[model samples]
Each structure stands twice: as structure tokens, then as C-alpha cells.
Target: MNFKEKIFSILSNKEFDNLTWNIFHDQIKNNITYKNYLQFLEINPFEIKNISEIPFLPISFFKTHRIFSSRTTDDYDIIFTSSGTTGIKSKHYVKNLNIYIDSIRNSFEFFYGPIEKFKFLGFIPTNRKDSSLIYMIKYLIQQTHKNGSHFIPYHNYKDIFSNQNDKNIFIFGLSFFLLDFIEKNNHLQQNMQKNESKNKVIIMETGGMKGKRKEIIREELHDILKKFFCVKEIHSEYGMTELLSQAYAKKNGKFQCPPWMKVYIRDPEDPFIHINNNKIGGIDIIDLSNYLSCPFISTEDLGKKINDNEFEVLGRMDFSDIRGCNLMTPHFLEC
Candidate 1:
């Protein structure tokens, strides 16, 4: 099967474990990092029958190395980097933009519905360009072809509120931007209550304060959103630049992975050891959609498995050792 067909079949099939193992073996054989990691662990890939036996590459590797499982490249179609106040940004070199686009489109439709059905409104508080989130939003808007689907700049409430109609509306915003928008448009709360429009409005927050505002707990954030939007639940998008796949949270901060993705909680003390369900540990992800890049990644986020298909992101580890620092040279640091 071709790449797209294989991924689609894996997602649609009920026997995910077998499908995942097959993909894992393929990755191990093709990916240099995976091969090296397996060698370092002194574990033969052929001996790894269970998915838990697979070792995940530390997420920091993206910062220091060019991470691609398949092709070596002198050029990349697009490069996505992590957002941060300080420290080296993790760069994801996308060889084929189509793969990333396919992953984003399929994952969203998997969780929510067709892209054309919703009027997407994206709000990014800052002016930073080349954001994967921004790119995804722009793609969604273009695909939707709805009159109201577009990116709103400077919290243009007048334009947004004026355009609100019976169509299903989805507002994608960064946490701080959403907070700012809601605070500035507090007067709309009562108006929203009275309008009684047939449109099912969903406020999906792409989590991150981005050092722009004081960090608040998810509960408080959701409460404010619920109060302002008059919606029963708030949705969230959980993703990073390192991986192609995304997990979504409809409500209550519980995120469910897409069929092609899986989350495993690993013991922070021993990164190789996978922990049981409901136990707080480091988050390790297997994103089969990331076949071009490394499929397995060990993230710095602290989280626990809610079930086989669901997980909750608690927070990041406070004192985790920085991984890619060794590769930084004095001249690079001076710059």
C-alpha cells in the first residue's frame, strides 16, 4: 500500500495494535535515529513484539539534528519551529508539505467533522509568522470557502459579531488572545444569550499563555470562556511542532488522540519504562502520520493516561535536563 492508503487503513481498522506494530517496525528499519536508539538500548527491533518496547527519541533532538526518517534533503518544503521565550527552538523540517496538510485535515475531520461545514475564525494575538497553527488555520479557512471563514486581526469584534449568522462557527485562538478578546467584548455575553442563533458556536483554544499573560488553570480558563461565549463546553487543540498529528479536547481538558496516534505515559525517572494507566508520568507519543519524520517522541510534558484512547496533559516537567545543548557551539551561543 502507498503511504496515504496505509495510514487511512490503519486509522479505519479496529486492530490498531497490529497495524501500529507493523508501522513501528518499518520506522525502526528506515529511521536512523530509531535504529541508533534501538542499538543504544541493546534491544533488537525484531524482538520488540509489544509497542511499549519501542524507545522514543527525546523531543530535543529536533533542535540539534535534522530529523527525517525517510529521505535526506538539501531542501525542505517548509520548516516549523517551536514557540518559546528563551532556549533553542525545536525545528521540524517538513520534506513534503502535503503530508503535514493531509495529517492536519484528516485529524480534524476525524475528531470534529467536515471542514466545509464550519465557519473558521482564527485569532493570533501576536504578529509572529511561520506558525504551524497559523498555517493550519489558513488552510482550514481556504478549504471551508464560507464567507465568514477568515483570520481576524486586532480583535475586530465589530466585524466578527456583525458576520455571526446561522452557520456553524468555530473560533480558533491562542489562550491569551481568547482571554483578551472575551474581556474586551464582555458586552456581547448578553447579546449572545438573546440571539438564540441556530449556529453551534465552538471556541477552540490552542493552549499557551506565550508569556503574554498570567498563566491560569484550565478550569478557570474554561469557566471564563463558558461565561463569555455562553457555550456549555470549550474545546482545545493539543499539538507541537515536532509531530504531524494532533489530539483534540472537546471538554473537561480530556484529550482524545486520533486513530493514527497513540499516547503512552512513561516513568520520568526511567524514560524507557512505560507506566500504567492513570499514573502521572512523562508523555510519549506515537504519531503514525509522522512517518516522514520520527514517529516516536518523548515529550517533556507531564501527563497521565485517561484510558487506552484518551489522555490529559498536566503540565511540563520543571527540572528536566536540556538535551540538545551539547550540540551548541561557542560561536553559535555568542550569536
Candidate 2:
């Protein structure tokens, strides 16, 4: 079966590991950037048997290098760019749009049922055009086929929540914009109360304050969001421009990845040694769906694994470019 089919059908850890190995082999053979990275480390791809032994390409390389694990370079369907609000932006060249859409849909469905059952309302500011989050939200809104599902501009909080006919409402917005929405609209509780008895409202933050506000801890931010939105838990989407797959946190700021995606924590001082579970360290991800680019990516975020299947993103690495989704916390330095 093709990777698109195999990725969604992953049922066991063994199957996922086996597929990751295959993807890694392909990446080493076809992707020049990854091959060079591995070569620079003085590691032979053939000697690596386990998934843990495979060296993940640093996510910053996406900004500095053209990472494509494909035979040709001209078949890019879409290029997803990062917010870059802090510094240089990272760009992910998606060879097939269908793969990305499939990953988005499957991952979303894995966490929160099907997209058709919810009305998606995006509150992302249109400061940049090539945003992967905006594209994903737009696609989800289209899939819902709901009447009031649309993108709302910044500072223009329209009365879109008035006539929701029993469908769950999902408001996907950036961290700053969502905060701005609640701070400016004091009557949000009253507006939300009208539908509270009938429809479920889910406010999901896609991280990043974008220099619009001071950076705060995720727990504090979630607490503010939960109280203002009248929701018990504030949902979060953990993703970046460099990744095709996304992890979702339903509650308490604990994120769970889909079957094809796995998260690992590595020691910050020593990038090669992966720390034990519940240890706060740098975040490393293995996204099998990132087959076109690089599947394994060592990110700049600091996180701790709750268990084998779940993790928590505490903040970014020290001095790293502040980006979307993951919050920034100085507590990581104490680790």
C-alpha cells in the first residue's frame, strides 16, 4: 500500500516503527539534505536498525536547507510557511496536497470525531498568506459544509454564534487573537450562554502570541481562556510549518499524537541521548506522514512525556525563535 494508506491504518507500535524505518531508509537514499546530515554525523544509514537509532534532522534546517525526500524537486503542490514573527521563517514544501489534507483530516478525526459534525470558525489574522494553519482551518471549514463556518477577521467579532442548529462549534484561533477576542468582548459569556445549553463550544488555541502580548505559561493562558470562553478545557493544536502531521491536546495541556506520529524527549545538552518519560527535555518528533520531506525532526520545543502515547509541550528551547503553538517558558533552563 502507498504511504497515505499505510499511515492511517497504523494499529500497533511495531507497525509504526516498521514504517518509520522504511521512510528513514527512503529519506537517506533520496533526500540530499538528510543524507548529508547523517553523513556529517559520521553515521551509516545501513547500520541503523531501530527507530531510536535514526538521527532526526534539526527543524531549523528547514529554514536553512531545502529538505525534500523526493526524486524530483519541481512537483511541489504547496509550500507552507511559518509565521516568522520573530525571525526567519521555515518553509515546508509539500509534494502532494492530498497527503497533507489526509494527515490533517485523519489526525483531527482521531482526536475529535469527524470534521463534518462540527462547525469550524477560524479567527486567524490574515497578516501572512502562506500559513499552514490557515490552510488547514479553511479546509476543515469547507469539509463541515455548515452555513456559519467561516474565518473571522481580527477585532471584528461578528454574531456568528447566534443560530447554531445543534452542531458543535470549534473556534480555531492564534493565542494572541483568541486572547484579544476575550479581552475585548466582555459579553462573550452571555453570548456563549445562549448556546451553552444546546451546542458544545470548543475554543482551540494554535499557540504563539506573535509579539502581540507578553508570553505566559500555558497553564495560566489556558486558565484565562477556560474562564473567559466558559469552557472547561482549552484545546490546543501542536504543529509547525515544518511538519505535515499535528498533535492535539483535548484537556489539561497534555498532547496526544496520532498513530503515525510519535514524540520523544531528548536531553538539551546532549541531543543524541533521549531522556526517560516525564523528564523535561527538548522535543523530538517522528512523523511518518512527513515522507516527502524529512520524517524525523528534532524541534526546538521543550516537553515531557506523560506516557508512551502522550506528551506535554512546556515551552521553547532557550534563545530559539519564538514561533506558534508551543509556549515560551524560562522553566526549561532549570531542567
Candidate 3:
């Protein structure tokens, strides 16, 4: 089967006026345990059913449970554990590493093919030796015949920023890290004097930002990045521990779900009733790449579903925000 057909059949047992929920349910259910999921779908396959009936496996289980199939050993690599977020502990996943890397490279080339020749300066924390950005940047740097530099400084941004050559360079940092870096070393402010008008020498941040230091507003943060990094756009990355695909946003601060993944906004109180667009509710992700694991993943994050492929991640729901963070706090840190 082709990739698209396999995804469609794996996700839906019966057709529906709304393909979103069926695909969403099928992906998550099958990921949990293929046999159990198939039986559940066969037994409960209706023309339409409320998303409420769908069980929400705890978001923390990326730590607590081994959700992926143990028998299927091929085409999967157990990636690193998440340091985790508030109220939940660290979680683990076996990533279909080849597929994961290829998708990331494809997305990067699509977005950045125009500026294939610019030097890359990464200031973010790479989660693994095989990080998506790290590996992709290496390729882009070589493809363009440019250099790649990772400014790994220990608690000093001034020294790091001072070390740069100041020609055309692309800076990619995690949101919190960038904020903290800029806040401490105000001198990097000089690099902004040079501009790459066509490619918009962007400053991008991957998702793992919320749990850290200060709470930042989207526009305010963008303004800070522009002021500090001297860049026109602040790209934001949309990725989670369990899923392989990623979505990118151009510092416009709105997360547009990639074609391979679907997002649903559910009632916070109900957390499963499919709500109307522009309504604030829980964000549930249905990822096609979760074929080896649970695909219909429901996140505790509240979001607004304005369109089929768009969502605004509005932080966590209920006491879950505080409650979830608590699960991740270290024994020493709690004191």
C-alpha cells in the first residue's frame, strides 16, 4: 500500500461525514495495542460516535507505560526520554527513526531550499545525538557548501554572541534558551545590523519552552527576538515526544498542523466532546506516524480549532497544568 492509503485504512474502519474523529480514534486505539484496538473498533464501529467515549490515556504514560508493540522490532529506534513537563514525569518512545529524519529533512528543504547556502548557527539543546534539526542542518550546511557551528556556551551568552563571525547566519534556538541568552548578553544585538531580505535569516525555537522560566506573550517574545537577534521572523516548532512529524510556524505565533497530523479541540470540562472552531478546549493529536505506537494521542493542552489544519495551543487545562508539572519535579527541586 502507498503511504496515504495505508494511513487512511489504518485510521478508519467506517466512513463518516467527519473523517477527523474516525481517523483520530483508530490511530490512537491501534497504537495502544493493535489487536485490542481492532476489536474495540469492530465492536464499537458506528457511523458516528461522540469523542467523549474515547479513552484519554494519560499524557504522562510516555513515562509510565510502554505503549508501543514489543513484537514489532523492525523500523523503530527507541529515542531518548523527555526531561518531561510540569505534573508529568519523563516519557519514552521508539521512534521510526529513518522515517522521522526523512520527514524533517523534507520539511526543512521545502521551507529553506531557497537559502541553502547560508551558514547555520544553532543555539538550541539537541535532545539526542540524532536530533532532527542537528542532522538536517548538517546536511543543509554541506549541501550549500557552508559551515555549521553550535554555540555551546556554559551560562554565558555574551561570550557566545561575541564569538560569531557576523556575516549571513541563521540562528535556531529553543524559546526559553534564546530568551535567557538574549536577556543576559545584550551585545548580540549588533548582528541585526545586517539583513538578508529575501530569505529572512530567521530565528526559530522548538516547542519545549513553556515549563521553563518566565511566561512570555507571543508578540512580546517575537519583538524581543527581533530586538536581540536582529531577525525579521521567529519560527516556532510544533512537536511532541510521541509523534514523529513536526509543524512549523513563521513567528506569526500560530501553530499550523502539518498534513500528516490532525488536531482537535475538545471541551475542557468534557475534554472529549468535539467542540466548534474558535472554542477553547483540549487539543488532541492524531498522528499518522504513530503506526508503531498509539496514534490518537490526547494532550492536556487546551487549544482553539479554527480550521482543519490549524490550532492555537492555549496552555494546559484545569489543575492539570499545576498538577501535571508536579509529577516531573525532581525530589530535590520540590524542596
Candidate 4:
């Protein structure tokens, strides 16, 4: 079905990228119901002769039922379980996931340039959560280690920072965990001299001022991260568990979508309408890395589009009008 040519053709061309997204988006929005979606997949079933036959499974459907397009379990390199706002588990079956992983690695290289190997610090949630920062950080650490890191720091942020006067250090942290670690260990904070002329460091944290504190100004959070880590600013990572690629912004920064990930702004008043660049609207993402699963996802995030490949994430919707994952569970369980 010329699958390789078809997929790459769309990804390789700027016009084809947007064109495919438009068709894919319309298919989902026009009929997102389970019954209708099955029909859609039936019509789009993988045909070795035709690229139009390849079917993509909607991620939400995985919560209730398995949606493996592969013929056997051995076909998958690994399975990733997606966490919900509630604790209910949803496993995403990945077939030939190597392509997805490679795309991700290449995208990071394209965006951040080359990353030097160094001591890796992880401050991520051990348990299940809707956010996939923990999973993504683990991958980042592994890459650093494989390429060349003196060592990966997994414990005692205090000790890790004590002997860190030299060497290029790369620290990846979670927002809340990092905050608590900093507050408890003031000595670590006091010992570090702010702004070293030759010190090379990168502190990348994902997620935001959601659960940790009621509200945190983006600039303030960036300042606090810089002070605590003795870095310039907190390099924030924007990604979802459901997405194959991640967007990165430097400390106290906004998100810049990677080459493999394309973001679009949909009108807030009408989800089906695409707003002009710079308008705040619902966030839609199309990630080439999400190929093994669903590459297109409509999110509840309120954001403004800056360009073809950049956005300013405004934050989640308020509680008054729409309940989050917890409130929506009843409806899902009913299915």
C-alpha cells in the first residue's frame, strides 16, 4: 500500500502536513462516538496498496478496550500504560514502536541541539498520574547515560549538588518534588553561588503550578527554579502521556513545538473552527512521533498560537464549567 511513501510524503512536506491534519481532525470531530469510529476504521483499514487504508485508533478508546492493529503480541517492543485524572489504568499497545522512539530522539536533537552527558537528577512521581513527565524524564536520563553521563543522580539532591563545582551537569526534575526538595534542604541552596561565569548546567522541569501551589506566576516559578538550581531559568517541557513527542521551553519560558510535533489553535467558541495565529483557543497537536498510537489529539488546554510551531500554554480549564477527569469517570465507566 505504499505505506512508507505515503507517511513520509506527508511528514516531509509542509503543505501535506497541514492537509493531513485537517482531514484527520475533521474525521474525529465529525464523529467521535465509539460505534461511528469503528466504521471509520473499517473504511480506513490498512491496505498495502493504498495509503488511505491505514487506520489510527483514538487514544480514549484504549481506556475501555484493547485496540491493537498488530497480529501478535510479540510484534510490540513495549507497552505503555496511560494514567488518567482518576486512578483507572489504560494501556496503550504499541506495534513497531521503534519508529516512534527514533522520531522522538531525533526531534530532541533538532530542537535542543546536542546534549552533553552528565549527572542526571530525577524528581518524578513514582505512582500513576495523568501527566507523562515521569516517563519522559526516565527516557531523557537513559539517553544521557547511554551517550555519556558521569552518572545519573537519583537520590539526595543535597549530596548531588555538594560536589558539583565542575563538570557539565544536566538535571531533570518534576515541579512539586523539586520545590519540596529545595525547601527541606536550604544548605544546598545557600552553598551555591548564583551565576557562575563558566558553569554549564541545564534544569528542565515539566508540568506547571497546578497541584503544588494554588497559583504560581510563570516568571516567579522560573526565578525560583533558577535560584534553587543555580541555573539561568527552569527549562519547562510541555508534553502529554498520550503524545510521542515533547515541546521544550527554556527556564521561565514558553513552549516551542518540535519539528516532529505540529500544534494548531482552534476557536474557543467553536472547537471546529481554526483561529488565526496569536489567538487563544483550544490546543490541538499532531505529532509524527505518535504514529504507533494516535498522532492527533484534541486537548482541553487553553493556549495562544505564536507561529506554526510555537504556543503559550494558558493552563487548564476552570472547575466551575467543566469537571476534570474525576467527574468524567462515571460516564466512561458506564461505557
Candidate 5:
């Protein structure tokens, strides 16, 4: 079977390991940029056997170079760009759009049951035209193909939550936009308190509070949102332009990855050292679904692994450019 077939077929941990090794080898051979990156590091691809030994290309490389694993330049189907407000944006040249579609659908279903069970309502500010987050949201909403499942303007916050459907309402918005909505609609708190439909609402923030308001900690942010939205817990999506798969945080800012994706905490000063347990460090991602592009990426975000199945995104590392769709760096997590 092809890499695409084998990747999605991953079930067991052993199977994931085998496929990752296969993809790593394939990328070193076929992906010119990755091959040169390993060569410059004086690392022999043949000597690498275990997953930890493999070198993760820095995510910044995506901005400076075209990170793709194809023999020719014309092989990509679409490019997914970052939603950064300043500086150069990272672009991911996707070879197979189907892989991304499947990744979004499968990842969502893995976390929240079936897509058909929820009516997706979102307010995605169009800062960038080729936004990966927008594409994911649009694709999922379209898949439901229901009458009430669609994007709403910022002024229509009441209309967004007014859907009285039986299906669970999955409301999506950028971190800043969600905050803006609630602040302006303080009446929503009083109104929603009386409405029985508030129980069906699920508010999911897509990060990015930069430049919009004072950056606050996740705990405080969730507290405000919970009070305003009248929900038990606030949901958050952990994703980027460079990655095909996403991890979801259902409650208390703790994120859980799907079977095909994994997160590792690496030492902030020393990139090679992978920290264990709750020690805060830079995040190294092994997104097996990012096969076409670079699967192994060393992101600038700081985080800690809670356990084998869970992790927490603390914030971004210092000196990194402030980008959109990124959470606030709490003063405490900075320590």
C-alpha cells in the first residue's frame, strides 16, 4: 500500500511506529530539503532506527523554504497559509487535499463522536485568504450540510446561539473575537441564563488574542468564557498551518491528541533533550498525518506532557514573533 493508505490505517502503537519509520526514510530520500537538512546535521539517515533519534526540522524552515516531499514542484494540490498578523507567514504545500480532509474529519470524530451529531457555528475573521483553520471549519460545516450550520458575522452573536436545534451546537471563533463578542453582549449572560438552549452550546476558541486585548492566562480566559457562554467547560483547538492534524482541549486547557499524533516536551535551551513528565519545555510534534509535508516538526511553542495521552500548551517561547491563533503566554508559565 502507498504511504497515504498505510498512514490512515494506523491502529496500534507498533503500527504507528513502523509507518513513521517508513515515512521518515521516504522523506529523507524523496524530500530534497529534508535530505539536505539531515546531511547538514552530519546525521546518517540509515543509522536512525528509533523515533527519538530522528531530527525534527525547525518549524521556522517552513517560512524560509517550501517544505514538501515530492519529486517535482508542481505536485501540490493546495497551500495552507498561517494567520499571522505580522512578519512572514508559513505556507504548507499539501500534495493531497484528501489527506487533510480525512485528518480533520477523523480527528474531530475521534474527540467528539460524529460530525453529523453537531451543528457547527463559527465566526472566523478573514485576515488571510488562504487560512488552514478557515478551510478546516468550512469543510466540517459543509460536510454536515445542514441548514443552520454556517459562519456568522460578528454583529450576529444572538443569531449564532439562537439555533434551537436538538443537535449539539459547536461554536467556533478566534480567541479575540470570542472575547469581543462576550464583552459587547454582556446581556448574553443574563439572557442565556434564562434560556434552556444554552445547555446545548459548546464554545471552542481557536487561539489568537494577540494585539486585540490584554493577554490573559488560560484559566482566567476560560473562567470568563464559561460565565458568559453558560457552559460547563470551554473547548480549545490546538493546530497550526504547518500541521495536518489537530489536538483538542475539552476542559481546563489540557489537550488530547488523536492516535496518529503525539506531543513531546523538549528542553528549551537544548533542543535535542526530550523532557519527561510535567517539566515545561519546547514542544516537538510527531504528526504522522503530516506525511506529505514534514511529519516531525520542532515548534516554538512551550508545553508540558501531562501523561501518555494528554499535554498542556503553556505558551510560546521568548524571542519568537507573536503570531495569530496562539494563546497568551501567562506570566506564571514563563517561569
Candidate 6:
């Protein structure tokens, strides 16, 4: 089967190890970074039997090298840069934007039903044209085709709440913006209670306060959002620019990846060893949809495996490189 077909097939199947192994072999053969790393370790890619044996490229490599698996070229359709607090940024060169589109669309639909059913409202503060998160939200909003599906500037609470309809509304925003919106529009709680509509309201928080305000625990953040939004629970999105596929959290902070993606926790002290499930360790992600780019990425974030398919982001490692998505200057853009 071809790459896309294999990805589709794996998305529906429970047997992931065999499929993962096949993709790993193919990736090691085609991906220069992976191949070179294996060569450096004197380990033949073909001889590797298990998915766990496959070496993951350090996430930091993206900051230095132009990481890609197929077709070495500077030409790219779109380049997504990591939101680093520092001036330096990690660049992900996307050969085909369609692959990213498929990954986002398919994964989102798998987790949240259909894209056309909900109205997407983005509350991102940055105006960076190259942000992957912004690009994803924009694409989803376009697909929704709903009247109110658009980016909600910090001051524009009236525009979103002014309209009264039964249309399902999904507000995707950074943590800080959502909080700011709640604090500013304290009357929204009463408005939501008055609108006795059957519409499903979802407030999906993409993690990070962006260094705009002091950081708070996820529980406190979600509690405040739940009280203000009059929603049962707060949802979240777990993703990074380095990865094409995303994991979603319906409630709490536990994230579940799409079938094509899997997370493995490796010992922080010993990178080669895989830790037991539910044990906190370094996050190593294998995204089969990242065929053009490197598939195996060792992220600096610390997390623990919930099962074979689920995990939770604990926090970032100490003294790790600051990611662009997590920290944003408050004055530059409103919630």
C-alpha cells in the first residue's frame, strides 16, 4: 500500500505495532536524519524489530537543521515556525500542505464529530502569518462556513455573544485569552443561562498562557472557564508545530492521539529505554502522517502514558528551549 493508504488503514485498525514497524522501516530508509542517526549508532534500520527500537530525532534538531524525510530542497509550500520565547525558532518545512490539511481535518473529525457542524472561533493573540496553530484554526473555520466562524479579537466579545442561535459554537483560544475574555465579560454567564438553546458550546483551550500573565494550574484555569462559560467541562488541544498530527483532550488535560499517531515515554536519563505505562518520562511521538518530514520526534515536554493510545502533558523539562506557542507577550495582541 502507498503512504496515504497505509495511514488510512492504520487509523481504523487496532493492530498498530506491525503497521508502526512498517512505517518506521520506510521512514528510516527515506528520512536522512533518522538514517544518519542510526548510522551514527552503528545500528542498521532494517535489523530493528520493534517500534520502540527505532531512534527518535531530538526535537532540538528542528531549531538547527531543516528536517525532512523525502526530497531535499529549500522549496516548500508553507513553513511553520515554533513559537519560541527566545528569538530563535524551529522551522518545519511542509512539502505538501495537503498532508497537513488531511492530518488536521481527519484527526479533528475523529475526535469532534464533523467540522461543518460547529462554528469555529479563534482567540489567538499573535499576528504571525507563519503560525501553524493559526493556520489550522483558519482552515477549520473556513470549512465550517458558519456565519460567526472567525477570529475573535480580545475586545470583540459583543460580536460573538451578540448573535443568538442554536448553532454549535467552538471557541478555540490560548489559555490566557480565554481567561481574559471571561474576566472582561463577566455577564456572559447570565447571557449563556438566558439563551436556553440546544446548541452545544465547546471551549477548547490550547495550552499555554504565552507569558502574558502568571501561570496557573490546569484545574484552576478550567474551573474558572467552566464557571464563566456555563459549560460542563473545558476541552483542550495538544499539538506543536513540529508535528503534523494532533492529540485532543475532551475534558481534563488527558490527550488522546489519532490512530495514525502514537506516544511513547522514554526514560529521561536513558533515552534508549522505554518506561512503563503511566510512568512520567520524556515524550517521544511517532506521527505516521509526517511522511514528508521526520516521523519520530523526541519532544522536550514531559508526559506519562495513560494507556497504549493516551497520555498527559505534565510540563516542560527544566532549562529547555522556550516554545513559541506557550509564551506570548500580552501587549502585542489581545486575547
Instruction: List all candidate RMSDs to the true structure.
Output: 3.9, 5.5, 6.8, 6.2, 5.9, 6.4
Model 6 scores a C-alpha lDDT of 0.79
**Once model 4 is optimally superposed onto the true structure by TM-score, how far is the C-alpha of residue 76 displaced, in angstroms?**
4.0
- Give the winner by lDDT: 1 or 3: 1
Judge candidate 6 at residue 39 and give its lDDT: 69
Model 6 segments beyond 4 Å from truth?
11-15, 159-161, 196-198, 319-335
Model 2: per-residue Cα lDDT over 1-335, one tens digit each: 25778888999998998898878878888998887777667789899766777787778777766678876777898888887777778888888889999999999999899788888899887656688888899889887755568888747768756775745889898998888877788776787766566778898999879788999888888898877777888899999999988999989888999999999887765777788998988899999889989889989888999899789998878844324213212122210
lDDT for model 1, on a 0 to 1 scale? 0.78
Candidate 6: residue pairs that collide: 83-323, 83-324, 84-324, 210-327, 210-328
**Candidate 5 residue runs with Cα over 4 Å from true position:** 196-198, 319-335
TM-score for predicted model 5 compared with the true structure:
0.91
lDDT of 4 at 122: 69
Give the per-residue lDDT of model 5 (tens digit) for 1-335.
25776766678999988888888888998778788777666789899767977888788777777877777867788998876769988889888899999999889998899999888877677555588898999988898767468886767654554555444888888888888877777875777776645447788988868577778898888898888878889999999999999999999889998888888887665676688989988889999888878899989898999998899999888844333212212112110
Provide TM-scores for the models: 0.90, 0.92, 0.71, 0.72, 0.91, 0.90
Clashes of each: 0, 0, 11, 5, 0, 5
lDDT of 2 at 316: 77
Q: Which prediction has the highest lDDT against the true structure?
A: 2
Write down the lDDT of every candidate, Cα atoms only: 0.78, 0.82, 0.57, 0.56, 0.80, 0.79
- lDDT, candidate 3, equals 0.57
- How much is 259 displaced in model 4, in angstroms? 1.8
What tens digits encode model 6's per-residue C-alpha lDDT throughout 1-335? 25776675664545566667767777777777667666666778778767787888777777766777664657679999987787668899998888899898999998888888788889887589888999999899888765668888878666465666746889899998888887887866787776535557898999788777788989999998888777888898989999999999998788998888889998766777789998977889988888778888888888899887678998887634434312211122211
Residue-wise C-alpha lDDT for candidate 3, range 171-267, written one tens digit per residue: 6677777777777676545554543332336677765464787777677878887777566778887776666666677657677754456677766
